[model samples]
Target: MEPAADMETASASTSTSASASASASASASASASASASATAAVGAMMDGRLLQENALSWPEVQEICKELEHLYRKDAQKDAARVRALARKRKEISAACQEKKNTAQQQLNQLLGNVREWEQQSNTAKARRDELAKKLQELEALKREMVAQLERVRVDEQSSKESLERLLDTYETARQEALKFQLEHRNEIDRAKHFMSLYAAVTGIKWDFSGDSIAGEIHIPRTQEIVPFEIDSTQSNDFETANALWAKIDAAFDALDNNDEL
Candidate 1:
């Protein structure tokens, strides 16, 4: 009985050990399968990284490198064209700015000339105004002088008129006196002629009157007037006195005529 029990116990133990060993081998196989799947996923990710990092295989990445190179070349050409355009635009702007500067300079010069001309014109105007002012002052002085002269002339004219009136009155009185003197002289001459006629008759002497002076000549009782004649003392005296009176009256008339002329 002891030997049979020991043999059964040993068999049971051996079966348990074989069962544990099989379970362990199944667990290790499952772990190894999961590890293999993880490795495959890591390899796919590595290939994507290689392509993204520009580490592609030669033949596979050839067309992609060519397309990238073409895009880079096109961008470089575009940048070069933009740079040239910017250079041309800069040149045109510089030229335009220079032209504008020259135009502004010319305009400034013109403005300066105009300002100078205006100043000259203003000076001339001021000079002209001063000259006119002086002329006006002179004219005012002349006007005042003319007015004073007019007043003086008016006063002189009034005085001259009064003097002329007095002179005219004196002249009228002188004319009346002259007329009276002429009438009296003629009366005296007639009376002397009558007296001479009486003397001639009484003395039996021939008497004759001749010329503007009315000279009287006496002759002795004559057979003819053409014969030589003689005047007596009385006749001579009467003739001389009459002649002298006539001469005096003539001189007075001559003086009056001279005064009228003046």
Candidate 2:
């Protein structure tokens, strides 16, 4: 009876080990499939983004979407051009500032080396106090000049950094404009949503605001729709702009051919 019980226990252990191994194998296979799917999606994501960008120009892409977005991302392409120009200028200024810093450091190192050498000389001629004083005065003058130059360079660096930040802000706004262009040229829903988003962004209106309604911090005009009624007489610049954009949207849709898809 003892021998039979031992055999049964061994069989049970074998079965458990086999089951554990099978589970591990299945998990590994699933993990591999997921990784492959993710890799495939990642590989095509950039291409899809490009296509989306291209789809913005009148519902059909004519040029390379990447280049088009880079060149004309914002109104009149002015902001895009400014970003490129400012980026180059920032690089140049940064390089010049770095070079100035490096040169100042080198000059300081050389002066210190000279001071050490002078100290060695003064020790050899302990009776020559006047000569040592003259050398010390000269070293102090060099140190003062180097410090002034370094201070000027640091101030310039800081100013350039601020300008770069401003330029970056403009560039980001322009980039968002380009993204909107892509959405505007997409299907009908996206095209309409783009206008709604624009209205919200420009007017700071997050919720529904009819004419004569107050939305959080925004005071809206009385209207049954998002746009103000008879916007021609509306004193609000935001409504005027929204109405203009909405007009263009309507015209574009009206001009679409019967067989044309978004």
TM-score of each predicted structure versus truth = 0.39, 0.24
lDDT of 2 by residue, 1-262 (tens): 4444544555565555556555655655665566566556644664685667544453334344444454334423544554565556556555655655565566667768888999899887885777879999999999999999999999999999999999999999999998997678778778689996887555535553455533323323332124222333345587775666456435433444332544
What C-alpha lDDT do the candidate models reach, one value each? 0.63, 0.59
Best by TM-score: 1
Clashes of each: 0, 5
List candidate 1 stretches off by more than 4 Å. Answer: 1-76, 174-262
* Poorest lDDT segment (10 consecutive residues) of candidate 2: 216-225
Off by over 4 Å in 2: 1-127, 188-262
Error of 1 at 249 (Å): 31
| RMSD, every candidate, angstroms | 36.8, 66.4
- After TM-score superposition, the amount by which residue 165's alpha carbon in candidate 2 deviates from its true location, in angstroms, is 0.5
Weakest 10 consecutive residues of candidate 1 by summed lDDT: 222-231
